[model samples]
Target: MPNCNAHDPYTQVASISIADYDYPLPESRIAQAPCAPRDAAKLLVDGPSRPIDAHFSHLNDYLPPASPLVVNDSKVIHARLAMQRSSGGRFELFLLEPIEPASYEAMFAARGPVRWHCLMGRAQRWRDDTALTLGSHPDETLRARRIPPHTGGEGIVELSWATGETFAELLDRLGQIPIPPYLGRCATADDNQWYQTVYARHEGSVAAPTAGLHLTAPLLRTLEDAGHPILHTTLHVGAGTFLPVKGDSIGAHPMHSERTVITRRLLQGLLAASAPVVAVGTTSMRTLESLYWLGAQLIDSQGPAALHLPQWTPYQTDRTPPTAESLQALLKRMDTLRVDTLEASTSLIIAPGYTFHVANALITNFHQPRSTLLLLVAALIGARWRALYDHALRGDYRFLSYGDGMILFNRNCKKA
Candidate 1:
């Protein structure tokens, strides 16, 4: 509970309170559903010059050939599981991340009893041995047993089912799509399709990487034709993605931990690419930036076989490798270990005054007020984020996960 995000000796900039990044958002402006013809949504392009208001269909026009687009291919799982207690009281369990295997792919493919860190809806009703049951399929019914709380309101939940279906498949059959709570409505059938990005492959995220939703198949094909190969890395966004900052200062907020996996191929592409890397969404941006710090840790430790990134690692660590060198060392370590993939979790809180090393630009959706996503924007463009948000609001761009998108230059990042 102390100041976890203390200022690093490497950073000379002063830290700002959470209040500095808060903005106004009208409820009516939040997009309840995605725009039809995904790429037809509005896109705001902010550069070193004036901001350009344009539609997403013209996204190809803004491409900087030097920076290839890196996207989060982490798929959104049907994380909301509803069940009734023995007393017939309805409650919901939203799976945040797996506590067992702790790997997104393994967790999804895992077929047996599974344990997960979850947020309970109507927690008080099911605090005792109530035996929550869910009728997932005619042939199979699922049951949940609550474990003791880890911390705060969330607790561990153990689940078992009779069907041979993997946990991911079972969730698909019975769980509801977890949507942005600000929508004030339940997920509809259409959301099962529209909420997912076209490139979604790996399943783990409780929420979709909304910015990726704007790039259609044709748009990607065009980007490829234009010589930018879209690369992927996975970061299973946790339920905390939507949680509001409770602390008065950004440093006091308990940053949510999310799992990220980067491949040897992905790292090589990132280093060798002639174009500056552009992260497709804040999730991707976080993954990309976290890699730098992760590699920095690797460099400092002489490349450990297993690596972990603490929530306040970035703020407190003075050991940082250059973007290219950090990535190169990571690649070498992975190759030496003969492992094709590097798996880790990040609780990184990207904020104003933070230095960026990977992405030169960010393509992200309009975020909630007082959210970490806004802080990432502040880190990228400084006070200009206020003007861009103002323009998006006044221009009637739909906001939130199912909303329009924006592109901001990494104009404020310090030279590596």
Candidate 2:
């Protein structure tokens, strides 16, 4: 059995050298593309005897019976747009998130000029006053003008078009799907379909929740038939998912905040669940865990008018209320606010020392070495995470976003 005593209340784990998480990843092991049928991809299951190599289709066999599987339904949008300055110099603008309206739904539906936080490639080349332009006709023309930088040096771009088409429509016509940069190739036509998950609906994320990529509609139906209810929450994946830990220690690294949405129905299912909920991806896992901390804020402190969980909030104290009590606080807030869904943002970092309030099993793809994602796995199973990766690598399972997946049972929580 794996040890579950990794949690430290003082957060000594944050000071642990990131070098401890490092591993040798040969380029050959990195998967450049997904399996033929998404469900045909390999699955590394924690079997009764030992780690079991199985097919993704056999996931139901390993899952705790009737445990709800939570998925991130945030859709990846066509966010990369290439345009040219009047001087014929080219630059790419990658849309990060909405700014003016501060709501994804409103920003996408707004016509004419809308502000967005965007990153520009070759931003130095373009004059601050000059506008980048695209499109052949006046009515359909799209233009981007620069605005004052945010405190973190993230560039703000004002996107405008003469056509009455919404920002979402303009993106569909001009922007490319922003796939993982490690793929070492440009997004092709197939990426428009292959890069997205089967259940994706809301358009906000720049990247797909990769673990959910392996699930097909038929496979999902099979899980439901086996009595596992599928629930959804949204965490719009950001470019920060690809940001590397530049510091030697985890404490020096800053976690990125992403927009999250959890519906009342999803919250109800989680509170009612008799077994540990299965998080489909790291994004879903983070969203679920962040909810507990958000609720605890309501019970312990005078809750903020809006939800915004800081990165160090979880590590600050160990006043963990019962999971039921914490979730009830959220429900009470919703009743008081008279809202069906809670919209919030979180920069929560889940490392080895962190205690998980929700989600005990994770269905996720193999992550990059020394990444925050890997740190999250270490938090669940301790030193065994290293052994688990070695098992997968030695077995020749593909790695990274377009790679094989695993269902890890948290040592501290109920196992399948």
Query: Global lDDT of each model?
Result: 0.84, 0.88
Winning candidate number (lDDT): 2
Segments of candidate 1 deviating more than 4 angstroms: 1-15, 136-138, 149-152, 303-305, 412-416
RMSD to the true structure for each prediction, in A, is: 2.4, 3.6
Model 1: per-residue lDDT, tens digit, 1-416?
Answer: 22334454223222466787788888999998888899999999996578898888888788787568999998888989888876788988888879887767788898899899888888876765667889945468888988875455588989988899999889999899998788899998999999899999999888999999999999999888888878999998887888887777665577778888889878988878776788999999999898888888877877555676776667666566678888887787888888999888888878876778888889999999888889888888889999999998989999999899998887655444
Residue 20 lDDT (model 2): 92
What TM-score does structure 2 among the candidates reach? 0.95
Deviation in Å, model 1, residue 286 alpha carbon:
0.8
Reference-based lDDT, residue 155, model 2: 86
Model 2 ranges with Cα > 4 A deviation = 1-11, 149-153, 414-416
| Residue lDDT tens for model 2, 311-373 | 888877768888888788888988988998888899999998877878998999999988999
lDDT of 1 at 152: 53
Which pairs clash in model 2?
none
Cα-based TM-score, every candidate: 0.94, 0.95
| Candidate number of the best TM-score | 2
Candidate 1 residue pairs that clash = 66-275, 66-276, 67-275, 67-276
